[model samples]
Target: MASCILMQFPGTSDPTVTVIATGGTIASTADAQGARVPTLDGAALIAHSGTPIPTRVIDSTSLDSSSMRLADIDELAGHIQEAFADPTTSGVVVTHGTDSMAETALALDVMLDDERPVVLTGAQLPADDPHADGPENLAGAIALAALPAQQPGVQIHFGGMTLPARGALKRHTYEMQAFTSSATTPLSRPRPVGVHRLAGKNVVVIAAWPGAGRAEVDAIVATRPDGIVVAGLGAGNISADMGRALGECLQAGIPVVVSTQVPFGPVAFDYGGAGGGNTLGSLGALSAGYLSPGQARMALTVALASGTDPAVLLA
Candidate 1:
């Protein structure tokens, strides 16, 4: 079910803020059987903030980000649009599940028409946990949302840091400092100044490539011998089907980047030569080194957007 909590900023004359809840661990509760049950909403989260802020429960059910479809993202985009359209709505906060949180945040970043601050927050543990991070994350998000300078683009706030949607990634399963940005530093940090550093003009998304296509995979090598990071199979392998396609791109003298399909490790060429490893490595494909898939993508995009040599991606 859905419910909400409202909390206004204490002792501040600032305008009210609206938090839209797309339920996750924050709203979870415990059933009589002791199983986790999340039933609260945005308003409930606001109430948990200990101050009354104008809040709304846009959606009550917890939607895992990985399970989220393009349609769901579109729906969220619509809500964000509507929320910003209202002059009374200063900023918006979205409570979301950690899975695919970066993807959802990125989608919102691309789709949101306005510049109003839009923040996405969630927890790794349920609200009932003594160590649950949902409440504090929500509080931080709301605090940022109320700020006038936080406007424009979408952001993910967790563990007291704010990250740009297109750049944020969940780096840990249990650590409070889980979400991070690649290459660029985080936008907001709760410190002495509590600054949210907006990105420079260099951030961007390139035209959708055929590899990001739905059906068969295809490779697109940009004009420069730029770094091309492939989300490879286990141990940095590529499926036979994808290997053939990527081989064609590599033979053209383009650098192919290989990143592990898994989230946590480096894309290594040390795996057995089977599964497109030998084939790709022989073609001068480079490993992503320390960069995650999302980080690799962002680095590539920004480099491209900046018109820098793709070779710089390796640097």
Candidate 2:
């Protein structure tokens, strides 16, 4: 909350929502050579979209979403929690890029399981485009953040739809409707309040592809990641050889999370044999029910960072 300014929106008394800007296409504009670059900060974007209630602005980062990394997201989480801890702020809206919006949103949802509204919104078109969609999307995000949704979880507000971070995904590349819920519905949201307390860890996600085997796992383990997530095939199934290597990961004291590479549905133990969900379960890998591999990684990272064993989250 230090150095953060209460926005002077015309004709407002009480500040209710705080817009945390992490550079995304919403704040980007075209360069001389037609390359898009993040040039607008949170305050400028808010100026275009306008706000209903009194609000504040915090310029967190100005990097392109594609250039963002896990460390940057961890820092952004701290900023959002700081805003939430402010007694005057009732809700928070996050303006991010579409590239990693789902991952950031899911991290907040898992780490901050509070009742406060944490809404994420971004744009597909750059701010400089005549047909840019950032303004309406920003307005929608602000409105969602200001309302008491009564549900406890992180949310992505775009295209007039508010979805839970648990199941939100960036499904499209060029479309404004960039997100889709692989699950039947959103799981509501979570966000740690009042501090950047999330644990810092090296977590990796390895997906199952044709001809993939133990070699991939060996390379991943060589880096000594704190945790590993398997983007398994249908029903969370990995190759037999890869499964053995994952067991080695567990034996090394590094936790492994099992999530499906498929678009939707929960991981089931219906299959048995090498590389099947049952084998991974026997090897002590945790299943992320219906969570995408990226989202599962976020959950594991948060849980491990908090010093909580993620075994309970497997359920």
Candidate 3:
């Protein structure tokens, strides 16, 4: 997690909410020719909202989601960890890009220690646009954060709804309602009273599993592969071709992790399916169960980076 600073006035009725501005289209403004460019700080963006919530802008440097790396995500988590430690700070809001937004959100979900709602928001267009969606999303994020409801963990608020960070994905390239929850109405919803009536389902996030994509898989098959996933189609399914690759990885002492690509489901084997899951399981490819791919990757990376057995993640 990155370091942060809290700026607030004493005796102010306003409740302080740390707004870490990581810079995205929401912070961007139109250029002279009307192209998007990064602009605005937390104060400037929230100044016109007329809400008494105090916001603190901890970081301003902006980067496209493609350019953001695991290290940057770690730093963002650092800032969030610091804010959650402050008793005066009610909650935190992170403004980021829609692209790769779910990845960061999920990353934070795993790293977060407290239950304070960490609201993430962004826009489809620059704030300079007359029809920009930044303001509303921003407002919705803060409003959710201020609520007393148990809207904890990493959740994304956009297009007027609050969704679990793990269940969110960018489904459209340029629509205001681009992000959606997986076959559900989302973990939380906005109300005249505040965010309420959470669906109360826990989203499992598994990562750092041993032999997820490299060693254990290589022992099962014999091929240099392009990509590897835990299951096939929506559940426990990986193609025969992929199964062959996993066999190779397992044989070569490289590990492969079996994670479901589906937003909701588990990675199981031999459930009377024709997909290669049973075959892959027999070949020693580790199953990630209900963990999302992002979580699995992190777990694997940490284990691999530390030179520990990737198999430990299966536990």
Candidate 4:
């Protein structure tokens, strides 16, 4: 069972922000072996934050975000939904691992529809470090979540910036400011999908290189995944052979979403050759637009799990 803690400070009002701790560097400590591991819970994290906001903490999962699966994300969504169901809950702050924070945020953005803000935050340094950034980031996320006029939908609050979940990406391996997004606002507003589980919806991401071809696509096709996301070149362009193979997958009724490997810009339909965005689009592949390849996978997973058309929902 998950532990729940309600905290009320002096001069605070009703309707408290819910802090859902799913374990990350924010809740991690160095083990005897000198390796960092998630050991702290939501209550401990809030105590470290030192933020005096009327708050409720739910210890959701103790995980190093890299170990999280789609099923784990779905379970976290249930906790968020339960928190929102309460009238006294103002907003939600999710303490997550920075590795897959953007992906989880995107999944929450598509899974839940609410006016209250859902802010995801994590630390680059482990909590035991003397210069750990978790407390400050958690305080910021809590402040954002507690704001009555905060913009709704899922957002990532890290290194002092509030980023929309859709295009948020972790750009650095070890930096205080780790995330960046190209758009000020979400590129597309998808309808909230009610997902029960993503058990068998095997969505895979394939990166396209200078010479990636049919062999790559064919290998992925052999696995018979429920969906595919092609991390194509600039403007979502792939090799002609890869495009032809992807078209065959499309003809076989497998949904393919095209995204870019570049850090910025939307996947466009500019070129019309066999491997261009135009070609992929013509072959019934949905363009991921501003979403990263990881985010596109989450969106496609949710779409497939909910019986929603990937093209219609992603558009």
Best by lDDT: 4
Query: Residue by residue across 1-315, what tens digits does model 3's lDDT show?
Result: 233444454554555778887778887887789777777766656753445656666774476664656666666766776776677677888888887777677656644656578888988988878788888888788888876646556788988877777556676789998787543544332111111111221222222232244334443233433224443455566555445555665666556677766766466676432235677677776765555565555444434443445455333
lDDT of 1 by residue, 1-315 (tens): 333343444433345566777666667777789876557656666667664444554664455555655445555666666667667677888888786777666545543555568888988777778887888888888778777745456788998888776546788877888787653544332111111122332222122222333223342443343445677656677655566656676787545666665655455676543235666777766665545564555444444444544435433
Task: Report the lDDT of model 2 for residue 190.
Answer: 37
Candidate ranking under lDDT, highest first, comes to 4, 2, 3, 1
Model 1 steric clash total: 17
Task: Flag the better candidate by lDDT, 1 or 4.
Answer: 4
Q: What is the C-alpha RMSD of each candidate to the true structure, in Å?
A: 9.5, 2.5, 8.6, 2.0
TM-score of each: 0.61, 0.91, 0.71, 0.94
lDDT of each: 0.60, 0.79, 0.62, 0.88
Off by over 4 Å in 2: 1-3, 9-13, 188-199
Judged by TM-score, which candidate is best?
Answer: 4
Error of 1 at 138 (Å): 0.9
Model 4 Cα displacement at 139 (Å)?
0.8
Residue ranges of candidate 1 with Cα displaced over 4 Å: 1-14, 32-37, 150-152, 184-230, 233-241, 245-315
The alpha-carbon root-mean-square deviation between model 3 and the true structure, to one decimal in Å, is 8.6
**Native-to-model Cα distance after best TM-score fit, residue 104 in candidate 3, in Å:** 0.6
Instruction: Let me know the TM-score candidate 3 reaches against the reference structure.
Output: 0.71
lDDT per residue as tens, model 2, 75-106: 77777778777766668898898888888887
Global lDDT of model 3: 0.62
